[model samples]
Target chain A: MWLDILDRGYRPGTKLLFALIRLLSGQPLPDAAKVVFYRPDFYGTRAKEFTHEAMRGPSAWSVGDRELMAAYVSQVNECAFCVGAHTATARQACHDASRVAAVLTDLDSAPIEEPLRATLRMLGRLTREGKAGAEDMRQVLAAGASPEQVKDALAVCAAFNVTNRLADAFGFERLTPQGYEAGARHLLKRGYR
Target chain B: MTGGHLPPVANKTEGIVPDEDDKQAAFRALADRVLNGEGQASARQRAGAFRNHGLAPPLAALIGKVADRPAQVTREDLAAARASGCTEDQLFELVICAAVGHSARLYEAGLSALAEATGEGSPGHVA
Candidate 1:
């Protein structure tokens, strides 16, 4: 939205990739993807790696949890683009889409376990305050999350903290509900690679 | 080498496996390069402008405002940065660097908290 380097101005490789994305999804590539595609070699590659490792990697936390965490961070950051995209992904990954709505409404009272809620709370604090101390970790642990789970969840939170800023800073365009669902499906199938 | 006490360790990765330690080191190195490396926007003063680490002036202002109060980022800000000769790609890279820096801070804080909770010698202490 801010910059003009969309499909027309992008490099040949990025333009080709965008064509593929459109072909596969039947919709234009979102601005979030465009920002990464603008810099395919350095920042884009690293961003993709971090996203895959944090959101799609093997972990005790389910994909739904990671996506929800990402959505929550974006919501807190007021990034509509990411909130839409990841909220859809979370809905797709979970059995009940209402849980995603509940989390967006109020994570503390959402119909989820205490451990996951605690993790979300910590991530919320991290997003707003940029710090989560030892007490936060102890709280998640007390709520029954293991160390590995905490690490994975924190990685998700951290990655989203980065991505939410990117989305806002670059002025990513808002997607329709259907568009978000389609983007989620693409991510679930193809991943960030 | 003599069978004697090791010298006082200075670097944090002295005892960790080289692969694991190098991975973290490489990430840190890359982050440093992104933020501090010479480029079109490198000549601008970065320190203390917006609580960001070593970003150009206009870029630090934009990224800092985006991170804290994104609503305040106006067309004037964008115009100023563009007028100051920052290319769109440079601005994009700066945003990514700033976001990654923010994430790294949170990640370090979370890991430190985990280390403290698990005690210094525990398995999760140094992640």
Candidate 2:
């Protein structure tokens, strides 16, 4: 009762963010409370709609770059939670899950193209060493990424750190393997994979 | 690098997401009763039994009535799942389908943050 009240006293600000987030994610507020709320960001779309945009925003920069960076960060956290979750999400994004799996598991033989692979290697160092520099990305640019792509790569890598930490710190409730598979499966059909 | 014959990125990769109608109905139900119907610590206790066990000492078996089952869920079942390292919400969120669109964005953003967190947060999966 106490937590429920605390959860429901929806005044606004960050609480609104979580409420909108939860609402958009499809698990809306419970029935009695759903409608009584003054204002909620329903987004007039399914949970996946908001997520699709959030997930793809990085690609406005580069494809393999974002997926690779997300996967890389999840792996860094050793978050059995986020690592597995994002691996599935990465699968939906079009990069081979096999490569993500291999990379996540600590293998160097990922199937990403040479340039992308170079980028991943650099990301690996950056994630492990604290930060990256212009020289760290020289190979990335040489491999084919532009200055913009280089910038986005860093952003994607940084974003993964934030998400992975959130998932790990909170001890994210997990889905069955079947559940994980279904996530990618659904995205594939809907076109956001 | 520019034109690496990487597989052409297509939007769709796999399954039939529920229709918008189903999704909306589900959202309404979700917002109203689903999450509130249960308790977090309670749900987590059963689901997190394995994790708790990983940290707690064992106790002798006791003869008693089985733990009461929630309207549909039972404690024993949750304990069993937890012992196997299962989780509840995030897993389900990862699986639920969205409308057929934005196929390209499935696991996109968040990389930068993840990497940053890994390095700053913990020793694993950082880069």
Candidate 3:
């Protein structure tokens, strides 16, 4: 990690909790978890709340769809850790790992529905260029996404945009496939909170 | 007000209905908290990161890179900012601000796009 303090700067209680989590899980807590725990009140608490609602709240988008959006945004931002973490979660949630891989590899030839493909296009533009024009939104709508769906997708985009940046800035370590699977299971069970 | 019509008409009614969606409400609260709430960093520092302006050289550079191209951020960036005397907690808060600020901009753009697509808040659009 770029920041040594963030790597090992937990309070005593948090440290004990981390130890317990590691012992039970058979793997150290991911650096993402560690960064959030480092300062719950400062930004982590609110970030977690927003993420939970965005990922698990009542929305037209499915859990798998949202996870895939996150992974796609991470991919655009070049955050390997989040791409791995959310790609695993997307696979688990959707139960279509190959399709997920296909979508990541090439959105055009990936066989996803037009609506999702269009939404991903918008998200990619927003992530890479930091803005999407009205025409971009119109494309998604033309592809059969509702206005509400656009909002939902934007929420997912916002959350991952924040996470991808932090993950890269902190230099979060990429996990093994097994590690990502385990973490995905945990995330699916517990949600982002 | 005088000259109000001379100014560009504000898209004052633009934006999603915040109270209607629990998720959007929570996101608004989180944005407010991250940019305005109490934290280890000074309010000015947080605001600077949020607006992507008015920062010291090292912090400005770090936040700009983190928000625009995080993949390019290196250990030296953080080290340079640290050398400028920010504690780890403060740096953490600043980074969050930059990230959230950028995300918020994107969110706003998406909302505006949606509004335009739906004619929800466009001036002179008939219901």
Candidate 4:
């Protein structure tokens, strides 16, 4: 990470907690998690709550779908760490590694429903341009997404749009594939809390 | 129709919708907490980060990078901002503000687009 504080400036309690986690897990915690723990009172508390709700709250989109959107947004922003972490999580949540891979590789040709494809398209445009037009929303709606689904998808987009930038700004260290899979397992079990 | 040259109703409601979902509400709260809530960075710095303008040279350049192109942000940017006499905590808060503000802009645009597409609001209100 870019900040030394984030790397080693955890409060004593947090440090002890991190040590226990490392002892049990046999690996250091991911930097993304570390960022949240570094300053929970400042902004991490709300950020964690918002991200958890966005990814796990009541919504039309499945957990896998939301994870896929997170990965896609991260990809658009060129945040490799987020892409790896979320792609693994998406694969685990959806139980279809090939499908996740296909979507990431070539979304247009990916084997997915039209509704999801349309939503991802809209999200991609918004992430890249930092704005989307009414016509874009119309396409998603016309693709069979209810208004609520659009709202849900935008929630995911908004969350990752914040996270991807944070990952890059803090320079989150990229984990190994195994590390990503482990983190993915934790996310599946814990749901970003 | 009776009022002379009244602004569009959509313009009056160009931001977050009144009835937001749980996720939307949470997202808004997160952004609000970072941009408007108490933190190490001054209110001026936080607002400047959100607006992507109006700050001293070091922080201004750093916020611009985080808001527009975070992938391009380097350790040097953080160092320079810190060198401007702001602590690491303040720099971190400003960076969070920039990222959250960028997302808030897109989030609002998205909600407005959905409103316009559904004919619930008018077009040409977004910048």
lDDT of candidate 2 at residue B112, scale 0 to 100: 27
What is the CA-based DockQ of model 2? 0.03
Better of 1 and 3 by DockQ: 3
Q: Which candidate is the best by DockQ?
A: 4
- Chain A alone, TM-score per model: 0.94, 0.63, 0.98, 0.98
Candidate 4 regions exceeding 4 Å error are B1-17, B122-127
Pairs in steric clash, model 3: none
Global CA lDDT of candidate 2, please?
A: 0.39
RMSD of each: 5.8, 17.0, 4.7, 4.7
Write candidate 2's Cα lDDT for A154-191 as tens digits.
Answer: 54554444344333322344566755655445434553
Per-residue error (Å), model 3, residue B92: 0.7
Estimate how well candidate 1 is docked, as a DockQ score: 0.40
Residue A145 in candidate 2 has what lDDT?
60
lDDT of each: 0.69, 0.39, 0.83, 0.83
Number of clashes found in candidate 4 = 0
Position A27, candidate 2: lDDT: 46
Chain B TM-score against the true chain B, each candidate: 0.54, 0.19, 0.79, 0.79
TM-score of chain A of 2: 0.63
Task: Indicate the TM-score of model 2.
Answer: 0.43
